[model samples]
Target chain A: MNPKIAAYLRDHAPATPCLVLDVDRVEQNYRRLMAAMPLARVYYAVKANPAAPILDRLTALGSSFDAASWEEIEACLAAGARPADISFGNTVKKVSAIKAAHAAGVTMYAFDSEPELKKLAQHAPGARVYCRILVENKGAEWPLSRKFGCEMGMAKALMVKAAEWGLDPYGISFHVGSQQTQTGAYQAAIARVAMLFTDLRQAGVNLRMVNLGGGYPVRYRAEVPEIDAFGDAIMGAMAEHFGNALPEMVIEPGRFMVGDAGVVSSEVVLVSRKGEDDPVRWVYLDIGRFGGLAETEGEAIRYAFRTPHDGGAEGPVTIAGPTCDSTDTLYEKSNYRLPLALDCGDRVELIATGAYVTTYASQAFNGFKPLAEHYI
Target chain B: MNPKIAAYLRDHAPATPCLVLDVDRVEQNYRRLMAAMPLARVYYAVKANPAAPILDRLTALGSSFDAASWEEIEACLAAGARPADISFGNTVKKVSAIKAAHAAGVTMYAFDSEPELKKLAQHAPGARVYCRILVENKGAEWPLSRKFGCEMGMAKALMVKAAEWGLDPYGISFHVGSQQTQTGAYQAAIARVAMLFTDLRQAGVNLRMVNLGGGYPVRYRAEVPEIDAFGDAIMGAMAEHFGNALPEMVIEPGRFMVGDAGVVSSEVVLVSRKGEDDPVRWVYLDIGRFGGLAETEGEAIRYAFRTPHDGGAEGPVTIAGPTCDSTDTLYEKSNYRLPLALDCGDRVELIATGAYVTTYASQAFNGFKPLAEHYI
Candidate 1:
């Protein structure tokens, strides 16, 4: 734990199982993304963690938002997001949400199918819509063209139907997938979507928006894509492909925008030796699967742990949450050592969990409520 | 989907994500277990799905509860669990919770350390306590002996300390681990804890309770252990080894009691083609990682999805939640075919999710809330 974080925690009310945001880190990250990708419009994906304060900060900085559901739309509205600036990027939406978006006067929504078009026609007829396309990522490792968009062959047909229905399609969009490690995946998607744009123009469909759905990877581990290099490659591709004729480029960056800026601090409840041969150490903390830090099933995401005062040392430990489930392990193998052999009542901070952190945390275990947010 | 379940969902307010209990299946499962080990007292682990209605049904069937936290304790209490009938089995606990349990007059609070003993003494002085031993699974595929327990070497020392402190140390307890598929593992754990009890007796610590922690497997797929056979093997061991001298035997069955009783119904939002390889079908429903149905890393648990209505003839389709994260796939491969080539606005049920299903789920992503629950 950082001394500054520990001090802030002490000053604030002690709330375990809460999310803590480092405002400075978030601001710097926001500025860094803007500086690196000066040409593209950064639409902060609010589905990651749309806490009011965080949303307000990002929106105040001129960051547009990509909302998936009506709840996210309401959150943006509550956070004072200009209705026009909110993009309902979630393609498969409820009629109620579509009606709500229309009622709220938010214009842009992502549309992928003909049935969706019928729903939009009944609900938000005049909504500014983007034709979501499934651009095959020939260069990527895990292609996400599985859902969310129409394939290249269906794209023009879908667009033609939109034209036939008197629905004015505004642009084209493609999502490379979340947690994309390869920068080239974005380039591959862009190259394909760009070609689709030209094809749509030839097919007599005029478009203005080119939304590259957000999958800009946050540095979850040190091995993830470098933001600057990734930014440069993507920007260079956009400039080279569309030049000044590029439609308004929108990217929904969720985890990339805030993952590293937030940390979850919790108190240790029990310390026990797990087994004989391994001499496994168990540090049961208040945060479990319900905490923002519960990503342990497949390829457990390793989180960094440290004490407020370095006391000069640490050791190998397997951290488990307070839940009795066997799968409640936070870290299967830890990299850093604790300042001392950590005991119950000691506090620990899980770092780099700002995005997708608390948004998906459960509140079932301890009566510990969400944490208090203190801006740095 | 099951017409009854579908009608139940349609009739009820759609605000709740329910854990559907098949009473016939549950009662049949209970009968099978009882038939296998008629002499053993089966304690359903309430932490799996602590909804009061579900607990009421389990209680009506004459099953005790294995509670891990104060919340579980409260649930058990609300369901009319007597203090002597309940055991607070979490190796770790909060002092306030300990005080609450003592006040509630629940006596079998399991403790793993002298520190916890001291805390219990201060909070619930002379509380009837059970010592938790961290026993090793000599040979098992999925070992859980790695997380929480006092080592065999320290077990005697902690027991001695408890006796000296005038705390009534009742007996020994060991958790084989959750989702245990191996039947021999329980036998090994019982033997170990029984020996630990004998050693404690020799060291002048007389005790009665011998708790074998819950890990009885539920049939997720074909590979899971047969519940009746598993119960028979464990109870038979106790009856043969300890005979009339066997202490009050306690077994906590979490997933076993409620796993197959529940089903999650979700509406398919969109189905599209992936690429030249296959048609990419995505059924976007209202469930997310908040539900235990979304396995740890968004990988759907094996056998997590089962349709209520046998779409008589079926086609391969991927069922996924509506979360924007690419990892939010519910099933990588379809187990069976759909009744028809499905389109938008279709609801399907992910069957056999009663255990660890939720009224509690991650509240991340659009203020994600749990669906309304029902008792049918």
Candidate 2:
């Protein structure tokens, strides 16, 4: 555990299974991103955390927001962000939500379907809109398959339709999936966007911006390249594709910005061996898949776990949540190991959980309280 | 859609994507269970659905509750249940939660480990305790692994420890997994319990109660044997094993008691094909995995869906929740077919969802509101 986090936990003695976010680390991560991609505008994805303190800090730092719903827009606005800085980033939106977003003075939007384009036309007339192009998200930990984007043919048709409907076909946006690891994924997606941009321009639609949507990976259990490497590769791709006449570039990073900034302090509820001959020990924690760590879905994204014992003898153990539900088990497939000395009341700090943890926690499964979040 | 649910939605016109519960249906299900298992006391599992109206109706019917947490015990009490009627069903519990339950006069508790038995002995002295024994939970749709229950040796030791700790070793309990289909699963579990009981009796431990833990299945897509068949099989097992004498029988039914009683009416947000030639259409619903239908985990529990256009030329479609996450896609492996005429704003009634839907909803992921439950 970070000494600061340990000290804070000791001082406050907040309830176990609570999230502790370090604002100083968040600001540092933001600065790191800014330093890496000096020319790219950063639109922090609000769905990652959306905690008021995180939003306020980012807003104070003059960061824009990539909002998926009207509530997100309202949250960003409430955090003192300008309306123009918020983009309705979700392609599939309710019509009423679209109208509400327009009423809230948000002009930018994203769509991948004709029906969604028509909704935008009816609700937010002449709004700046982007068409997301589907790309092969190969190396992303969370591979997004045919969920948000459309093909080149559909994109071209949507752009033409937007122009005909008096909506500003302003840009192209695409996500290379969440916790995207490969730098080549961005380069390849940018190339596809470049082709689409050329096709749109030939069709009398000159797009103004290219949104490199959030997918930047954070260091969890695996090592990842720094933000500067991604920036270098992306800039090289932009130079190769768009030349000197590049449009305004925007990078909406969610996990990369805040994932490492937060630590979840959970308590060990039980440690029991299944049988006398069984080698695997089951270590149950106060929190589980439903309690904000849903990203451990399929045990694909393994967060670094820190027990109170730093260098104690380690043993392989299966981790589970405190809930009665069997599906709430977290690390059955992954070979997770922890200190053998870990016992009940011992704190386990789940590192790099700032993004997608608290936001995805079930309200109350089995009457277990949703994770309480604390900001330091 | 069930005609009653359709009428309720039409009459009330609740906001899109809400859970509409039929109190009459719930009472009917309860009555059916009682008619089947006349000797078994019914203790409704509150984790299934803790909605106020459901709790109130169950409490009014004099139904006992299987509470997993202190909050659930409080909810049962607030709903007018007697403290003695509530059982602390969860084996893994916080020490503070045990103290709270004890203070609230709840004595019946379940534990599967020595640590938990010790905690109960310290906090809930002289409590009526039951040791959960590990059973081969086969033929169940949602098969629970070793997250709960202890092996035979461990369970025997735990029971002995419970008696030594001055706790009442009242009985034995076992869950045959959720959505259990085969009647033999119960018989097998009961036979195992009988053997354990015989062994314990020889050791001078006189246990009184036998908890046939919640596993009773409900018809989702496939037809399950009626509650009567399960009751007959269980009674047959009891007669075969115990001969003349029988203990106080208890059945904690969660899904079977309330599953068919509720209907979740979710709106179609969008229906779009990935490509022109792509035959599979993607139907986006306002509610998804995070919106309370999480039992769709691994697509294990397939709830029947009724679209507005029921018989209008059905086509295979992949259903997804209205979120940016790719894992929110509900049916990709499962062959889910919907009407081709289904459009945006069309309502789809998810049948047999009363038990696990509302309580599992994530608290506002991507700014989507949880399924608002309405009871009629």
Candidate 3:
């Protein structure tokens, strides 16, 4: 854990099962990302962690915004972001949202399908648009379902349609996947996107931008490549493909920006075994999957743990949240082992959980309150 | 669709992505459950859907509630339920929640481990307690994680210790799993619970009740056995085991009580294919997994979708929710087929969503509001 967050947790000892975030860490992460990729403009994905304090800090850092909905765009606007600096990045947009974002003066948009493109054309007339292309997600722990983007063939037509509909065919975008560990993934996606760009250019559509959507990894239980590595891979790929005529580069990073900036402080509600012979201890925490740890679904995001007895004797354990539903069981087969000294009422911290925790919370599922957030 | 809900949706024309529930259907379902399981007391599991209107109606129908947390207990109280009529049924509970529920005069607690039992002894002294035993969930569509219950031997010891610790060792409980299709599943669980009862009686603990935890299936895309079948199997097993001296029977039904009583009214945001030659069309809806169709996770609950052109020619489809995250995609491999004529901005209804829909909604995930709910 970062020293600033550690100090706050020790001094304040806020309620259990709450997220305590260091807004300073968010700025540091933002700076590190920018320093690593100096050429690409940072359009902070607001869907990652749209906390007012975090947004305010990033806004002050001159960061552009990639909003998934009008509500997020409003959040960015409230955080002092300029409308032109905000991109309506979600491809699946409602007409009302399109009208609202256009009227609010947000200039950039994204679409993958013709219907969505038409909705954008009819509602947000003459908005700058980008087409997301489906790319392989071979090495990402949380691979996207290929639900957001379209094939290259469709992309070619969509760019032409966008221009014919009087919209600016601004750029092309693709997500490698979240918690992407392999730098090669980005290289491969950029290569595919480059082919589409060249094809579109030959057809007389001068697409002027490339959006490298978020997939940068944050340290969890496993060590990941440094942000500099991703920067080098992306830059090398751009140089290899587009040479001296590179398009205006944009990177919309969600998890990479805030995933490691916060910690979830929870208390052990109970610790027991199924039987005397059972090897696994069931560690029930006050927070569970419904309590905003939805990333733990399928045990895909293995969050590291911090306990007072970390170096003490340990045993195999199955960690679960406090909700009654079994689906709320966070890690049963992930081989999580906690300290033998761990018992009921022990305070523990789920490390590196800032990005996708708070908003995924159920609206009081199993009667637990939505996760509380503390921005320090 | 229920005529009342259909009429409400037709007449009111509420915004897209809303749940229109038939509260009158809730009364009918409750009555049906009572008629089928005449010997068992009904404890409506509040975690399934704690909508105030449903609770108010169920409370008026004299239903006991199985609350997973203090908030749910409080919700029951607000619905005018007697504290004694509610069960604090979650095996994993926080110390604060235990204290609060006890202070609120709620009785009848559940515990699967010693630490939780000890907490009960200290906080809700002399409370009626039950031990949930691990049972096979072979035939349930939504099998539990085996996170809730302990081994039979452990449950036996826990019940004996309950009396030693000055609490009433009330009964033994087992859940067959949600959306259970086999009546034999309940029969097998009852036989197991009956053995526990007999063993505890011999051990001088004399546990009285048998809590058949909720697993009653609601019809979705397939047919399930009638509630009468489950009731018959349960009663038959009790008679076969205990003869004429059957203990107090109790049931906690979360899904079965209200699963099919509601429909989700949504609009088609977009419709497109991955490529021209691709066989599957992607149908994007206004709501998805984060928007409270969470039961659709892993395609466990196959909700039958109704489109404006449902009876027309159908084609293979991959259904997804309108969000930037690909994880928000609801169904991909479920082999769902939609009408060929379905297009953007078309009204669609997801049937059998009355339970486990509203509360599972992510709090403005991707800036989309938590699902709007209407109980007519």
Q: lDDT score, residue B36, model 1?
A: 72
Lowest summed-lDDT stretch of 10 residues in model 3 chain A? A362-371
Choose 1 or 2, whichever is better by DockQ: 2
Question: What are the per-residue Cα lDDT tens digits for candidate 1 across A205-250?
Answer: 8778788777666554446767787788888888888888877878
**lDDT (10s digit) by residue, model 2, range B278-327:** 78888999999998888887899998998779988989999999888888
Q: Return the top candidate by lDDT.
A: 3
Residue B293 miss distance in model 2 (angstroms)? 0.9
DockQ of each: 0.41, 0.75, 0.85
User: Model 1 misses residue B54 by how many Å?
Assistant: 3.7
| Residue B359, candidate 3: C-alpha displacement in angstroms | 1.0
TM-score of each: 0.87, 0.98, 0.99
Count of residue pairs whose backbone atoms collide, per candidate: 20, 0, 0
Which residue pairs in candidate 2 have backbone atoms (N, alpha carbon, C) closer than 3 angstroms, thus clashing? none
TM-score of 2: 0.98
What's the CA error at residue B122 for candidate 1, in Å? Answer: 5.4
Please, what are the lDDT tens digits per residue for candidate 1 over residues B196-301?
A: 7778789988877777777776655556767776777788777766778978776777777777767766666666554334644556666755554544332424
Fraction of the native A-B contacts that model 3 recovers = 0.88
